[model samples]
Target: MDIATLYNANINNITTAKNAFDVLATTFGKATEAWQHEIADRLTAEHWTGTTATSAGTQIKNLGSELQAAHQELSFVSKALADAAEGFAAAQAHLISALDDAKNAKLNVAPDGRLTWDNESTSPNFAGTDAEATAKEISKRITAALNEADHADQAIEQRLSHLAYNASSGTGLDAATVKQDQAAVAARDQVPATGTDPDGVKRWWDGLTEAQQQRFILNHPDQVGNLDGVPAIARDQANRINLQRSKQDLQLQLDHLGPEPAHTVKAGRGSVENADYSAWRTKHDDLQEKLHSINDIESRLAGDKLKFRDNTPAFLLGFDTKGKGRAIVSVNNPDTADNVVTFVPGTTSRFGTASGDVDKADEMARAAKQADSTKTTATIAWVGYDAPQSILPEAAYESWAQNAEKDLARFQIGLRSTHEGTPSHNVLMGHSYGSTTVGYTMRDHNLPVDDVVLVGSPGVGVDHAKDLNIDPSHVYVARGGDDIGIAIAAGTLNFGLDPTWDSFGAKHLPAGNSDHNHYWVKDSPSVRAFGEVAAGTWRL
Candidate 1:
């Protein structure tokens, strides 16, 4: 089968469906509104003296209700079809762009799925100046274009099939119906599952055209942001776009609530309007907090230097405003770094507290550079899980750690997949409850990391370093002298044995006389040792 031909046909069908649904939606929508306001209301008001007249009124009311429901269903289908059409069109455009690039590069594809460079051009062209180099470049471009086209063709078919199913089965504009439609769309287009091979994801992502990448990022930001094996740069791009969209959506919701009443109390407390106002205010405040967090990241990126880096740029690797909020930011391009460190924060972590976490990551990056100025190091603040919000019993339990393990493991896989050259000396550093999350992830899944550092850790969900699936020599721990709470809870509220203890069979680092939060501070021994570990220069 010719993939290009198949894609073209699907694009045409989508366009036809979009136009047809639009017409039905507009016609039926107007008729339904007219029947309800003009005919149904009048029929209800009539003083029917005869039984036949009353019966006719009842039938008319029922018909009006049916028409209203039909109109709503039609409207929903129309929008769905329109969105599908737009997505198809974008996919088609990207495919065409890729084809154009292939053509410009003088690459030819045979029906048998093989690419060849047309070096013997009859027409005068820029072919022979650097024939070998040009041929290699053309081969690469054609390969990428073909891969993108193939993926796009498959995606379009799946989406169209799902849309057809929904158009036939969906009944009304209820929440369930809407949710079903959304789930169908997501299932069709979401990134590969967590269990998918990281290498496969890397190959697929590397082959996509820039336009195709942008399309996925805009259409399915959440999936792209969390997708294992996606490049940090691409994830960052998608998450930032998603962040902006979320803020806009929230603002629109606030605007729809209309202007606040003048007579309402100043704080909108203890009044009839208070509840509604308070709800909206809370949403608004959350939106602002996220916006502020994003702005802070942007400001750091704009600066000439971020900690140790002189010109390296910062990026937002992941983001979410749902729940308590989660974010992952990289202080440098991890893809090309010789060393990389991912830091996970502990309790009460949220987007509102991201600025400080990000600062600490920057400090880590700087310290890593100081440890070995010749090696490139990237440090990421990975608040990519819903960490416990409080120190309550529920939060202190191991269930939260279990729930977070898969996500953390997937994130580490993503880092490995996107690396450009030889694998970096990757390190996982966790503090407090964050250590529990890392421990569970390492023990449950095969995380591609070189070193593990647990600081102010309660326990690592295991009695010994052997259970962590890493070399005991590579497992490091640091506990501040003042972190009495963590020391006391080591065998109680903690998951299992404390890594810093001699019985845990892990290397212990000097942490200095500081508290839980000061481990990463400048001039701290703990921070310096962490830097050395991340740089692969530390010794026992």
Candidate 2:
């Protein structure tokens, strides 16, 4: 733990140990990966009959997952060993180099790390070229190196304790979670805080090599999953892992709570509180809600056959259980898309309704194709903010809209920052009160979208279209026949001018016949017009 002990430490043995474990982990991973693929389809009902086979098949499938889980644990240890060895080697190198400098300078470094004079030179009274200052600098570097090595050692110890806990605990390792949570601790330290602005974050991300990025994504998925400036591919991979781990964690909690929850029992001969029952009920309800939110996300990720319709894979950009809940689902990879339309839903939207929002995204993508079939497109259902959950008081206030302005603008810019090729024609389409949110985003932040489409909007935070800082010609609006009440809310509710009005300077797009939610009804003119905007072919 001290300078002398570290100075004499032999890290070659550590390297040898790390190399051996790396090989073992790789070999084991390959074997389990093979096992994972083996039983996935081969052990189904068709391969056998009745009870024993069905039970074996289920357990075998689980065994495959557990094998992968064990492989991940092995990998975590291997990675930790490698980190420890590297930390020690770097620290030792610094110390040795410093010692050599001291020796060359005719200065002596004491066993206790103090500077001393040589027997011939000055004898416990010498410094470096700059006297005391040089000695201090050398001492500082020496201490820093030792501290760094100590940190690495501590990290290994912590991970070892965690590994032990996983083994002794009845709950086994989850296949999808073990690697990122345990193996990626080192990478996580290198990441910028989640609070960093999108553009700054993008600079750091783009500076890294592709292999480094991939490693970060594999090991530190939680850190990058919801990051605005990260590319869609990385975000998707990270968020998918996040989704798996979230489900596993929540399911584990639910299992631990057990089936029978205590209910309220009478107290004395009078009405009284059942604190335990109340607490249990509250926790149960909250967990169930979170589970529902996660399930909604799972449903939307059902791949090509469901919402995606075509063979395009779903890209989950973000998901969170904050506020009412938040989810951002993209129908395709936005990084490579020629046109990207992001839909921000209105009041009462939550994670429970995530599936419907993604359905709308799919419908938007389909409608965009109707405008121009050749254009690569992505439609995103972005409920990335804490939307107002009530109609009476919450929706009447602009707090929700104001709070979302920064993130929405950063997200739009992040799309431009990380996109693969030519600039995408990005459209910000807001439905109902979502328009209010978009309006704030544009007016305050000068959100750089190619077009702004307002559907069934009450107002968009600005009185004049020009105030949004976009080309007035690019501003468009639509309404539903049943949304008259929403129109009355414009201006009077302090939400700004009605965008659908001729004086607002935004051209009117066709409104749907039915209701506010029918704007993207299949084959509707309203949907097609919105699609035209996404396709960059819409004209006044």
Candidate 3:
């Protein structure tokens, strides 16, 4: 297209983008306000009871959540489009201004692109003046203006590139992926690490348009989900989407493989078909296990009677299918809670076993509520690491814990960053090998938590509480009567010092006469102690 045609087309495009943005902004505002009002009204109404209230609350919360997500998505796209439009407009203005300046200077271009002074004008003729110098100056101004226009054009191109991803096309850049990419680009330089500017990171996150924030959640969930300085809600949303996508992809693979074997195999030597089948079976089984874990999460969120009685609602904050699989679910929204407790499981912990861990988390949540009914409590079941699959040599080593330290530390940071109003009294509670992970995390990096609780721990990867970098007084230890193996291993295996032992110098809490697995059981002394600790009411 000719330059004039291109310019006009760009103007029209900018106008269209701005108009679309305005429409979205209006709709988003109205919808969000309506959702908030509906939820508020439902929460305040006193006439509902039992199932009615439960169902209504769930539906209202879902609606509000959907509305909020839609708003964020729209906001990001609109802002991006608006920005692109403004860029194009500025470029056009620059070009126009340059042309006007040329005219004011009494400079004229012949049809063959030769420059000359306007003879008809009363301004000084180029013939007598320093014509070469004046021409050079005019040329310089025009070049700068063109350069500005070129930069703006490039900006518009970049913006359009992001907008071009659509599901209808075969480019595979769906809405979620597009959002994710945007977030990734925006956060590419702001990743949180040791010595990084945390406040600056937070400001960058806060400065993101809602769309960018949503996109970040959608695209780089693993990064955002575990990022120390991201809000809990964003993490939760991102994690959930990631989890669902993972499940869908796995299911699709399984479907492609079919329910039964492709062909009947002979019982003898391994063939290519057999190898393929074996690989497929392994993948299929792994996928099934992961799905089971996801189902457990869904059940908890749905308030299954068998899994939980409190129906406290659950929010998935992180998930992964790599290796043994990892999941993080909160019993309630941690962002608005008064107390938050994260429970990390030990050996044999995987997505398949996540249900039991989630149940334990629920129990912890209940206990916290029991300790202080007025206070809101959120207990997170953080299976966000590859735990030892069994009580083998691997379980005895510190590698697992070492590998998990950074993730655990970052998860704590995420909680602290996302929390609203006064910060929650956050506690990290670990059982068995999980305690080792928590210990390593505290030792390797600073975790912003009010307290650290170790129960039935083999060792904390440290010889004493002082080595943990946490205030000795803030470290609490409890051991069940039946955890004799863990007690013995603490000294024998160089797994570090036993926090429960007198030499470890951590506050001792009652574990009751229970087994290692029962430490978090409702009404158990260990559970009560955990409740007290989580509520910030624990005493020596």
Candidate 4:
């Protein structure tokens, strides 16, 4: 068979199918258009005869059916074209195979009908050379190594699965989904104190005394699986011994373990470990402080914004203050140009939200002012607009971002008017949706600001810091490990607001802790980085 001719036939079939589909689609389109025109004409008829109307209605119905059928036929033709193309490729492959077989054919004429090849000389006929022996040894070693490796890998996988099951079954913490975790913990706890360790449990049994091991095994009879190649007598004895020991240890722990603290609310669906008490206290204290400070802050929001005067230039009253919202004007020519910091809050972000009972927005400003208080810098909480109440009913991120942009623009314009002659450097700080606002302002509004500090950011809504239309070197980001929002904000696609701008190919300040809407305070990694930036050292 001619391969080219066979391929041509297949190609012709596909082309014909495709052409048929196209023609059907065109016909359907034209028929629909004509039917619509005919319907319009029939509606406008002056001689409303019943027969004439019926014929026109019949024509419309028939045309509609024809169009539907054409659409269906086009779909069939398209599928047929695809099938024909595949068939053509298969035919091409078969033709090539047949041609190859015909060229390489070997006819047998011997009485026994045995087949032979002219290229038989090339076949290996090893006669025990040193190289051949060495090759064979290498091959044998390689096979053994591969087998060992596969076994090791499979063993590890099986052991890990067992461990997962044991961990999932942990005592006193088992929920419906975590039974396997309980099992995992039980497996570890039930380990036999066999002086000869279980195969994969050497790590867990390392430091137990023989007596303790024997006791642990005694109490956990049901936990034993295979004895990991140990002698049957020894393994059974070890399991009995270890189980008894575990019972004693658990009883001793229970006796000493104090009752849960009155205010110790659980963090998640897990047992409170020994170290969590301190964490619980710290959070509790922080929350209390937040509650106490908010009321004091709400009283301060009613007045007009303030400014100060210092004698670096002989009673210069107004210096470097151009923007909307309240301003924290620094008096003297402090070492750093950025002697003032402005916070632009996002949607629904107001004075009361930061703390349960206190005006947290104002409290943060006061804390910032008190933090670095030689008049070197001051902080302003710019709640320029009434933020959206809730994200669900009305305040979506995008909608708030748009609202923030408008207000931030007005605020920036107002600030520019305030500091028309003053020349102090400026820093714009934002959080969560506020970061979006800041990013949009810098990129879209072209606000003249020095540095932008973003904490607990979801995303700046820009691809990179440079894309925010600001000086890339001045953008800073921070995220804490325990932050609930970080999971959703840390990825490129999800925009979980990861602070990995430096590693993710953008210039930014050192990342700090910004988890669950809480910015890290003094002594925190993020706070230290913020201090560095506030002091005008951008490299941190």
The number of the candidate with the highest lDDT is: 2
> Residue-wise lDDT of candidate 2 within 51-148, one digit each (tens)?
99878878887777787777777766676676667667777777788888777766778788888653433555444347567777778887876776
Local accuracy of candidate 4 as per-residue lDDT tens digits, 19-97: 8777876786677677666764556464555887779767656556555444443444354344334434444544444
Query: Comparing candidate 3 with candidate 4, which one achieves the higher TM-score?
Result: 3
Q: Which of the two candidates, 2 or 4, achieves a greater lDDT against the reference?
A: 2
Q: Write down the worst ten-residue block by lDDT for model 2.
A: 120-129
lDDT (Cα, tens digit) per residue for candidate 1, span 1-540: 343563464666766876897798788888878877887777667766589987888888667665665565565555555554554455456546655655676655565435566466575643454556655655555455455556655555654565556556644434455566556445434566655666777766654445556778888888787676888888878877876787677567656766653444555456444666677677767766776776776667665345334656788887777778888889888988999999999888887678788888887888888999999899999888888888876557888788888778877887888898898999998988999889999999878889999989999889999899898889999999998888877867658876777999999998988788899888689888988998998997
Residue 495's lDDT in candidate 3? 79
Looking at candidate 3, the ten consecutive residues that score lowest on lDDT are: 166-175
**Rank ordering of all candidates by lDDT, starting from the highest:** 2, 1, 3, 4
lDDT of 4: 0.46
The whole-model C-alpha lDDT of candidate 2 against the native structure comes to: 0.78
The per-model lDDT (C-alpha) reads: 0.75, 0.78, 0.73, 0.46
Q: What TM-score, to 2 decimals, does candidate 1 have?
A: 0.62
Model 4: how large is the Cα RMSD against the reference? 35.5
lDDT of 3 by residue, 415-440 (tens): 77678899889999889899999988
Per the 3 Å backbone cut-off, how many clashing residue pairs does candidate 1 have?
0
Instruction: Answer with 1 or 2, whichever has the higher lDDT.
Output: 2
Q: How many backbone clashes can be found in candidate 2?
A: 1
